[model samples]
Target: MPLEIVMSVSFARAGLILGLGLTVASGACAPLRSHQGYIIDADLVNSVQPGVDNRQSVAQVLGRPTIASQFGAEDWYYVARDSRNLNFQKPKPKEQITLKISFDPSGTVKSVTRTGVEQIAKVDTFGKTTPTLGKKRGFFEDLFGNIGTVGAAGAGGPGGGGGGGRDTP
Candidate 1:
């Protein structure tokens, strides 16, 4: 082969190698983003009232709660939440709120109890959002884009071309 032709071939090979390396490296370091929210404390809700607290008066004071009793209208529940996140990644929950109030047969306040008003560090898996700009690329996009067409196309084998088939000589 001519010396110039050989040198050009070597440069092209180097470029292909560099491109493949970069593609793989980028895949390994994909930027991560997430968001999460939760209610940090239920006591803050005490700004209203509890325990034998006046039901009608409390409702007027705290406004309507987020939840109510499933079987009857005698019980009411108030809920609070906090959320945080970065971007593509899922959000994390920082706090939660659960208020339970029971009323007597005459619709008077009987008892009030609360639960799940504790700080937590649980991942908010449901906060996933699909990106709008581009279709989500997977491992293949980076792998194929970086590898040279010749090498990548033939990676499957002699007869496989771009697929994973046995390359029979």
Candidate 2:
């Protein structure tokens, strides 16, 4: 009976140690945050015809715009943006962008518009300067340089090594 108790205790300790090791290793390999922004309702914009779509009807079709003109009140902005921290790493976009469609006083579509300033990248910039390290690197350099390193692997890692046993050679 005493021997059985000792063996069980030993097994318990081993399991605890293994669990702790796994927890720490997982914590260390958290992914880098990734941000993705794009126009979600582009189809809604294309469907509207300048002459056919009126203010009330357009509102019914596209739901509502994100921003409205405070002064004019005739303009409507339908905007959708998605910014994700795939791992929650660094500072990302403070602003988002979408298409702006305007209506004239007669209630037909007046102008279809977008400003370059507000549109976020569908994919985050890769070749530009990295904010965390404050250094810029070319696209290929960042790709190959970080590949297969111990730090980069996480759940659904880019290389397909950590989460699943299967990986592309």
Candidate 3:
């Protein structure tokens, strides 16, 4: 091969490798996704006093809550989670913020509470077997269930079989 051609080929291979490495590295570092809810500034959250701020005023300053209380409509919850998910891997939450705002019967802000990642709850499943509906049977029963249904499928009833084989005669 010509020296010039060999040098150009080497440079092309190096460039290709650099480009592929960059692509794979970029994919491995998935962009951080922020699941934001009720985007209100921290200063605004503090500005709305419990005793002084009313529902309308608080709504104007801070947006609506991400979710309301399950049992009642007075409690408002503002939550946000920052997570990174690469490919098919489960999303790992890097940061989480939850703001709970309570309202009195008069529709005025009563209190504001905030919680961070410390509140994350770890849930453990009971066992490896997923819940399925059916009665548990032995291995023999499972193996014989289909095998025992053979005579019932042909043109024969219980204890009534027609054998054309010469051995049966």
Residues forming the 10-long window of minimal summed lDDT in candidate 1: 33-42
Q: lDDT scores for all predictions?
A: 0.64, 0.68, 0.80
User: Clash pairs of candidate 3?
Assistant: none
Kindly provide the TM-score of model 1 when superposed on the true structure, using C-alpha atoms. Answer: 0.40
| Candidate order (TM-score) | 3, 2, 1
Best by lDDT: 3
**Against the true structure, what is each candidate's TM-score?**
0.40, 0.47, 0.66
Give model 1 RMSD, 1 decimal.
Answer: 22.2
Question: Mind giving the per-residue lDDT tens digits that candidate 1 earns over 1-169?
Answer: 9999999999999999999999988776664433223232445456544444677776765667676776856887766655455445555545555676777777667776766636344454545764467677788897786665544555665444666655579
Q: Positional deviation of 36 in candidate 1, in angstroms? A: 11
After TM-score superposition, what is the CA distance of residue 130 in candidate 3 from its true location, in Å? 3.8
The digit string of per-residue lDDT tens for model 3 on 29-148 reads 876565655555789888989889888997788877788877866888888887777777777778888888899999898998999978978788979878778898789988887775
Model 3: CA > 4 A from native: 29-33, 85-87, 131-134, 137-169
Query: Cα deviation in Å at residue 161, candidate 2?
Result: 84
- Per-residue accuracy of model 2 over 93-119 as CA lDDT, tens digit each: 544556678788887988787664355
Worst 10-residue lDDT window for candidate 2 reads 31-40
Q: What's the CA error at residue 19 for candidate 3, in Å? A: 3.7
- Model 3, residue 65: distance off in Å is 1.0
Best by TM-score: 3
User: Model 2 off-target regions past 4 Å?
Assistant: 1-13, 20-39, 86-91, 94-96, 114-169
